[model samples]
Target: MTAFIENDVHAVAPEVAISFFKGIMPFDTLDEETLRSLARHCRIDFFPKGTRLLTADVTELTHLYFIQRGGVKAFLEDENGEVTLKDFRGEGAYIGALAIIRGTPANLNIETVEDTFCFLLPRDIFLGLIEKQASFAHFYLKSFSEKIVTTAYNELRHHKVTRRSNEDLYLFSIRVGDLVKTLRKVAASATIQEAAALMSEHRVGCLLIHDAVDAEKIVGIITDRDLRGKVVAAGLDFQQPVQTIMSTPVQTVLSQSLCFDVLLKMMDTGIHHLAVERAGKIIGVITSHDIMLLQGHSPYYLFKEIRGQQQISGLYPLANKIPDVIRGLIGEGAKAGNITQMIAILNDHILERMLTLLEQELGAPPVPYCWLLLGSEGRREQTFKTDQDNAIIYSDPEDETQAQAAAAYFKAFAAKAIDHLVNCGYPLCPGEVMAVNPLWCQPLSSWKRYFERWVSEPDPQELRYATIFFDFRAGFGEAALAESLRTHLNQHIKGRDLFLFHLARQSMETRAPLSFFKNFIVERDGEHKNRLDIKKQGLTPFVNFARVLALKFGVNETNTLARLKALRDGDWIQAELWSSASEAYELQMQQRLVHQLRQIEAETIPDNYIDPADLSDLERRMLKDAFTVIERLYGVLDQMYPVT
Candidate 1:
């Protein structure tokens, strides 16, 4: 079906020439002769600011816009006249190909963001070019991906702030010394009257009360709220020592610690102020106000909002807002691990609450049982809501007859909890790996038996089913049950060369889809033909790689990054290897998340498969870099533990 233009389309005028589209994408993929033939039909057009570039209802979208200068924004107007900005194109970009190729009226209106200049190629010519170049054809077919990058770029523009570096944006990178405005120090023995006077004089929210014995040591803190709640409200004597009203055992953070993690400490403990310590002495203080002003809608706000929920039904709306929060954070350049960790934390609260509510309805568990989160959720690396991989472990019953009754109660509780979770947006596990499955809802001793059997006799077919169990961690309930199992499993597997080798061999079975020629190895056929499965091919390689190393080192950390860090700290892995592998894993996760969000926004089922051609040049290179790192790591693993 090769399309050979009948002949070069002669320029309608001097301004319409083949030379116009020389370096533009898609056009760049064209050979000189073909490129010239198509460019002959291209005409340069100017669009003034506020001018309509394209109308949504136009019966014929005759032009394919390739921007040469300035900018244009595409928007979709829905019912009730609400308009959502869809995409933006600047110089070296193109638009209108999707609508023109599909032969459907585009549900978008393009308007000039500024006075813009573009090379317009007629719709008929563009289709002819698509048939001529496979690369050019692919670029247009991945409209969703192209839309995602443009939308993300627009989001970044909308939220861009001046006078802030990447370090300033990340709470974890902000040092306590960098955030403090002033240090107000006071003696612990200072009278409440004197403290009130100093507070009034300084107009500060809190005072760093030093220890009576060691002047350099900050023993407690007193805030305006403390004075109001403890003295003014409770009717305590105002003349008494400030220590009486001051909060003892004050929360503190190292001066060099990340402000974001420290903020989490304050939020977790309901502390308004935290003393900043440098070396061994008090340096300054950081208040909730400081973080609030610096970080808008911090994780603390989300944490409080999640925990404040009193009913399961109320969580739906709040949960819906989470995607916006994630998208905003990603736009602002937050790390993928940190973003996913925050999500996993918030999700834990929702699931734990659901379980608590179910307990109230179904009556308390017949025995102490731990609700274990497995797979990505267990690893705290869940970027998208896929399906719940969970199981329950209960105390072993004394009598064999009692086991049946206890299992039934737990199975019922698990079913109710899973049903509620599904309502809250977590889909049911397609593999039937959830706790409601009786095979997974087992007594602690039974779980031990399951692990021992898998380790002792490693069957590849059986290993696939039982392997993810190693990543399990207690999400709620009696954590001791999960803890005991982890200890038992680790002790059994440690130094078992055969078991570790088998695990490594099994993990090595999946390889990152990076080819020697530096092109992605995509699906050859089926529904996702020619698409890259970033999860199974990209993410799973690192997940499996890290799990093997963790088992080798007896590391209990479930997170891929955490496991790598533990290995690095133990001097078991080279620093360079750790950095590259970590970066590669993060890049893959971020790519998957970005792609999944696009699917969700489009109201389609979110998936890991992505069309590489849709990615901008920069993104495609970065993807290759990430895959290259994974390939290198696999080479090292193969050398160390060769398969028979």
Candidate 2:
């Protein structure tokens, strides 16, 4: 009886190990018996720090190792004694899975960074285990498929970044040099009056001072603040030597450091100015104000400055510069989505500036009001040339005269602002769905009544209007005002199955770009003839699909991509399908950016069309793959909301 009990205990140990493996591995098909057999043959090994598991010369070896704990760094050492790290791997991941499965020599050296425990299964044992168990084989196949997908995605991203042709490197160098203050030097013996006049004439804040006796030595610095505080405040003569008042032991930055790094250091040290020095000589000076301005002044910054501006016309110059700022961000390789969000935020600032000016011109609102951004602007996804789609919502005043006065005031302000925005490059909405429209500019109660009408009666025209307006995001004014509107909509629409079905049907109006031959179908007419309508065909389907799902589920997030992700997380959509849809959207956006960049290089305006003849074979193939994803998503939409 004692011997039998011991045998049972030993037999169960592999089952326990298999359970642990099953939890982390991506195989849903693996059964208990198959896992037990695989686990019994897997040998657990412990290695101390510096233990190398594989080397570059080890070819034709087929074995897989799973790290249970500790870390490993895979790297390649060159003949020049330089080492480049390939990747870092930690707990629950298999190393050599790719190479082992492919029967190739290790492309990288893997060594333990610390004492590590890992399960090692030889190729023959792994194959034998899989052959005996159908479930185990299925899991292995799925794992391999996932790895291939991941590798493809990574390669795509790498190609996208590398194709920019060193533009990022050149821009980074210039920005860093400017931030580090590399320029010409001045003398310490210069008079305060001379320094102040030079600063004013050059429109510079600080001047670097070098020693007269030793030209290689940097002695001090003088800034506009030094003139105001040290010279003027002290009631000293303007003719006094700048060296008497200039800051000594000048703060310096190395020429090689990154601009962002220097900015952080300056912020940390609370210094307004930093001098760039090379071999003990002052090269140039960078002031806090210069950094702030070059960093791209925010809407808040503009608002603060515009508030003190005596003339309303002063806001125009700043508003005009918004497009240039956006171009600068794009040149710096800022993500498109992030750039759009920043633009939207800054647009709000511009709106606030206009509102402040208007308040002075027209007085405060007779009732509390909110200015709502609609359509893509409301979604905070405006690019450089997005049009105005906005409305006004205000609390209903008890007095009819007071309410009419408030509406008139807001409408006038909005009309003026819209005209300015058009001058600033944002065209007016073609449909005139703007706050200046009396129907759009309404009290909160009227807005609710309009939405209720749209929700209760599911007509085609009304559904189209609701689709645009439902993506409303607060641009300027009391956010609670927009929230109140959202709350009312949510309450009325939740469990209103008819409204959702209509929305779903309307969303299906735009089909995916896939042709019968699994190729992208190009536009037949209009300005984009023979070219793909990327925005209309590739992006809108996903965006519309996400929007309808979000509305049905009552997910309030406005960004299209965020809405899709939220729906997936809530299990309203499958994870794999949503992931594929997101990848397709990203690829489409990336192609658009590349086209836009080319147009910029050619000094022409960019558009959303991409001619198939213009793309490389690889890009053409990738675009097809992306279209396939879109088609799959459309299938999901059709299944969920079939058109009668």
Clashes of each: 1, 0
Cα deviation at 479, candidate 2, in Å, is: 1.1
Clashing pairs in 1: 171-260
Q: Write the per-residue lDDT of candidate 1 for residues 1-644, one digit (tens) a residue.
A: 11212232233452344455666665665667776666556777666677676777673577777877899788766455766456677887887776787787654687888877777778888888788778877666555444544444443333221122432345755777788767897898989988989989998888989887888778889999989999899999988999988888977788888776676576546677888877777778888778766655566666667777787777766666666656656655566786787678778877776778778878877778899999888898887676889999999987867888897798778887888778778889898999999889999989999988888887785567546788999999999999899999888887677777777777777766778788889999999998999988888888888888887778999999999988899898887688778876876677777777767767888889988887644467667867877767777677768877
Error of 2 at 30 (Å): 8.8
Q: What is the C-alpha local distance difference test score of each model?
A: 0.76, 0.70
| Candidate 2 TM-score versus the reference | 0.60
Q: lDDT tens string, model 2, 1-644?
A: 01111111122257556766876754335677666677777666677778777776574455677887898887666566566335678988777755765567775678888877777767887666566767666666557545434433333334333333422322223444445543545677778788788777777777777786776677888777888888778899998777888788888886565554455455445576877655554557665555555545322244345446655567667665655545444555444554565566666666766777777887777888888999988777776566789998988888979877886788787788778667656778899999889899998999999999999998998898887899998877888999999999988998777877888777777776777877768888988889987777777777788888888889999888788889989999988787777766766666676566556556677678889887644467667877777667667767877767
Candidate 2 lDDT score relative to the true structure = 0.70
lDDT of 1 at 536: 89
The 10 consecutive residues of candidate 1 with the worst lDDT sum are 1-10
